[model samples]
Target: MGASKIGSYPCEEIVVDIVVQKSEKIFGELDVPPSKLYTQFATALALLAEGKSTLKQPLRTKDTLAILRAVENMGATVKRTQEQLSIWGVGRSLRPTGNVIDVKNSATGIAMMTAIAALSPRVSVITGDAQLRARPMPHLLKVLNNMGLKAYSTKPDDSPPLVVLGGDVRGGRISVRGMNPSLIPALLIPCPYAKKKVEFLSCGDSLQLNLALDVMKAANVKVSVGKKLSIPNQPYRPFNLRVPSDLSAAAPFVVAAVLTDSKLKLNGTDLASDRGAVLLNILKKIDVKVEVSNKFVLVRGPQQPRGTKLDLSLTPELLPIVAVLAAMAKGRTTISGASEARTMKSDRISAIAHGLRKMGVKISERKDGLIVEGQAKIKGGEVDGCNDHAVVAALVTAGLFADDKTIVRNRAEALQTSYSRFISAFQELGAHVGYAE
Candidate 1:
């Protein structure tokens, strides 16, 4: 699989279909790295344009590699030296050979591939693993549809095996509701290349807004945000970005520290990072002591304080980890303003409720959020990951204080999407853990 050919790249598929057996010992101190969510996507897209791009401190995850591989498949040249990645894009257009693009379990790869395919004149079919196919794509689809591009699932219920007819996009006003802001970058990247101006109407608050703005600015697109956006008909520059360590990935460890009454510190995590401050506020309400410096967050826990209601619409990624914390707090906690959260993952709140219930924890669902009753003690038992990364992380966090050993099946299945070394990180923190191959 040389990097120059369009259709000769070798594809390796990996599958894990069992529970992750829990380690008896709890985790100890550990130092985590920076956020990498936006960096990887930005790099892959940069490789689509005909220019040289420099990406710094990029995320080195499987999804990042998947995106890079797709870019390589489309005839781009990417070289990595030390900590920097240099990509020479294939130019302004991709000649799609009507190839079948398989993205495996990478959601970032799927989203970026969808956008990149929009630039091609050929009909492209994009497919992934079963779980990746099951994730929602309506928000991305709606925006693409508004641009006069036809994108639909190859299977029923809008699951992937997505068929994209790439051509000139007739861009116009589009309204997106109940969608995560973190996903907006995937939509916005391709709009500038469209012939017409694209107007984006959103519900005003999304944590990914700052990241989207950053990407737009990097690409030299002038974006003005008020209630609505009026995109201009201007040529934008190609972009290169350095993605930080994913705060979303760091959240579960934050919750784990809180639950186990330990003093934990996360380095290379920025308070100015999207949703970090909001998560800190929520943890504060639950009496988790936190101190933020320029480069890290020092969290001291074991507060045993009362729980408070939260509106998690802006930070849906925090839901799974927060759910576990809320279940262990002293009083009932309510999380609202997150009806859109369900759109991200249909089984999210329900899955948490089910896992907690099985562990003898009390929780209920509301119209817009969840209501959780804290338990004095959580009795560990067998749990299912539901093929969601956050769910798997939450189960592991819960295992920290369980009365008995907690086992999480299919936890490793989600590592392909995010946090590939999650289990290894647990081991680094002194947790007793192992994986069965």
Candidate 2:
């Protein structure tokens, strides 16, 4: 399995398949809670295994549930007691009895489920929705194939419908580096059961490297990294993980506050996140007022934000939110070095441009990035989410200041990836928002 060039189309409909839970009172303008998607899924899987597992502040997102569903299908039971989820591991010898295990639209689910499938003697086929299937899985497949696991795509282009023939894993070192680095950790999840050592050579993607470290540390897989790394043979250990809040999810709110004429404070976030800090720097460059405290970050909307050029390749996840901020800025903003940003399953730059253009914002697509020329005022119009959660959030954020009502079709779709409680949060912040059944 190797990385291949694939073309993707702009999606038309963004369907949000969430039954909004009962609305609860806002706990006094607190910074939103941490919502780590990967950690939540991993925690659920750990809880389903044969052990006492503790997950702290788990993020309840679609991808996380998809992973938990996979674990449940594999004969593991999970229980939530008090504030923590208790997972009873079914051990490594457990096999999934099902024939078709659908992972839905979750990338983490596809990756982890496929990895879990490799551990069992049962032949399992992992599939997902069209969007998830469009996402690349060759990186994980390549790693598994390297470890002597018989894994193949049911289709010619190496898309989903992955048929994994489970067997004994002969672990070996594999080199992973690429534009989409998230696949690195996905490849490592199944390596603990390997009889040999597994080494990962990070190609300088910080997020991917960090995720790999987190995964290795959580599974208690002895991993050593420097220019190179080694994983020692070890028994798979279940971990009690506390999922961190998603800074990516909070970016829109942060940008919205920056664009408005109010001082907004977001609590329960890590300013230390690479993406968070990068956004802060971008704000500073654009002359947005910001103050950071020990526990929270406060952003004051500039009378008008000054736009500038940025290469957001390292922090591509923030592109959509940042683009929204640019849409409200005082100059031309250019985002480059983000051609690879499309790999995240959301063509955020293009999506924002598409939705905003309908709202009378001047947006143009560059070969590798986007250009947004801010206007003094923007009129609201109907926008579509296009099946991208980040795009939905961006549209909602943009709509907040629009002169008229900006109806976002399928706006609720954002819950699938992150920010499940966005509508309520917006309402709590005094925005007049409602959903139409």
Candidate 3:
């Protein structure tokens, strides 16, 4: 016997039983909203800063709300209204509200805030929901522990429900696997206040590190990149910036525009920021005709998506919908360099492959990547969301050209994880997307 096929996937894809209705075309004009990651980062950075900062037109979704709550517990002043978010940074003066900071189901929230909590002189327990607990706590714990934060978990598996006995973070040189893109920045969030310079060596050598480093650079953290990042003692400077639209959220619509005979306008996004920039670059590389302006990204897709090898190493969030787009594109599409996606909120790699396989697309799975053979027609069948948001969105995008009815199970609610306006946006674009009540 080789290996048990039981629980060895990059993630656990629990099949849900749902259906998709076909649409003749896609068209819409909507502001593709600001980055939740940026919004959440503003909260964290604000809490770590010396003054107040405002996040304009930020996404106040479940995930960002989770981060807000965690920081609020850590004494970050957050006042929310319909238009903007205000964070009053108490800097290193923050004290833990309780012994535990519950990040709900957000891994990014918990992981990013965990490092901040470790800077406190009091012991703080950072934990989250079942999905969050199941995800890895990232390999950064060893460095944090060595840095005088004393981070640990009962399972000792580097996953969550972690307890960090606080002390002065004597920041020193540490090495990390860059595959978990969030981990590097998470560790760095509080390092500026640490007693010493925090140097980082990328053990995994993932190229995604640049994105995280850009985020840090935006926050005014001095990160010198080489074989190791030499970060000196720095101050958290106040930043007044606009958060750009999310590229991860922009993917399905981009796919919708390309696969259907409709034009879609993504407002408030110019393809200049991280998630949005990365996705648009990939789309451009594949010869998708998208016009990027200062205020909005004008995209009209009805052209057959051409096949190309996409490396999703830095942007693992694109794995699901990218796979869906690849399935419908012309020729063969190869996606590589995203092995870490195996352990996202779900194992996205296996989930995308499994879902596509249901709708009659030929897919070959590797430990880290996937190969999709583009077909002229999308066959009608059922697929599972694997209870993952990315999987759900991927399956939904694939359903636009699906013959007759296509069902996606265990994913309707996961839409709130990222975009609450997903179905409505598609519906506005003339797609037959709705709830199955």
Candidate 4:
């Protein structure tokens, strides 16, 4: 999946350049876009359901398109509309083309799709973009093999391009670290279709499994969860659902709002949302003023952020923007429990530390997290986006509060992978941002 095929921003150059924000404060109501993360996985799961599943207002982004194509390749009939996309699921009866599926830069799509492909009696090769290919997949591949898929990575380190010979899942169990985002769902989604009942032993905290379960529950698949997971062969029953606004997308604004003398009302985002809830907790712990309800999140900022011991155990995607907030805060901040971020779209912990340091931030990077002594004002300069969406977004958020000109290169294009409306959302909140036209 090339960048151009899905209408992603040009890969070679900075297509849209943003100027460093002058002293500005954003205030207003913003309707954050629906969650592409949930939309992609739910759409994939819908493709495996027994009947028509309607996804109302699903995000129309390059990343979700990657997963949609994966499901399309597996024989799901997709009907598109302005307000909805309906997937006529083939359920366990996938007509595998035995063709190689290109996921471009979405690691989760490939992982979940590979699990679905293993249920078919065909050989499926899953590949992705350079960054996606470089990500760690062997851990998930090893677990897939234990479930009897014969899944293997073409690369030595168990990275993609991954090869899976699909036939039958023997429904065995495997123990693994809890932090691999793609591992649990990749297994849980396919295990039910296995010849026998599947038991998955989570070697660490399996909180992410609850998300997979949430998607499963929405699709009408029952998964027994406790210390270990018990997956029974229950057919996915299709249903209509609307995707909530993405909290990950809303994160930059949250941090931005906190740092500026701004008040932001975020619509379409819910307090009960998994990502939003985590963010809310973190803000409260750090003393940022936030009020959230089931329908909206209201945030007021310039609250003088303070450094507190933080654990990103459940929400590692929070790392980038959290790093920005930490850099702007006024004390020692320790971020831990997110070492798994190393395998994401970028080496996030390093990317955050290095990129912020480029802006004159004092920071120390650990294997799992970061330690930062906050500065009164960030002396902004130039930083690289590392072609990671979160990295670019984080940097952009940082720029909103930086002291001087901060030129972020190559990252403006990364917004296509997650939130293409990032700049617009910021601008809606009265940010002084624009492309280098």
What TM-score, computed on C-alpha atoms, does each candidate reach?
Answer: 0.87, 0.87, 0.90, 0.93
lDDT of 2: 0.66
Which structure among the candidates has the greatest TM-score? 4
Score candidate 1 by lDDT.
0.67
Per-residue C-alpha lDDT of model 4 across residues 28-84, encoded as one tens digit per residue: 777767876678778888878878999887887668889988898888899988778
RMSD of each: 6.2, 7.8, 7.5, 4.7
Off by over 4 Å in 1: 1-33, 178-180, 235-240
Indicate the residue-level lDDT of 156 in model 3. 56
Which candidate leads in lDDT?
Answer: 4
Candidate order (lDDT): 4, 3, 1, 2
RMSD of candidate 3 to the truth, in angstroms, is: 7.5
Please estimate how well model 4 matches the true structure, expressed as its whole-model Cα lDDT. Answer: 0.78
Candidate 3 per-residue lDDT, tens place, 325-365, comes to: 88878899999988978888788999888878878889989
Off by over 4 Å in 3: 1-19, 203-220
Candidate 1 lands at a TM-score of 0.87
Number of backbone-clashing residue pairs for each candidate, in the order shown: 13, 14, 11, 0
For model 2, the superposed segments whose C-alpha errors exceed 4 Å read 1-28, 44-50
Q: Which has the higher TM-score value, candidate number 2 or candidate number 4?
A: 4
C-alpha lDDT values of all predictions: 0.67, 0.66, 0.74, 0.78
Deviation from native of the Cα of residue 198 in model 3, angstroms: 1.4
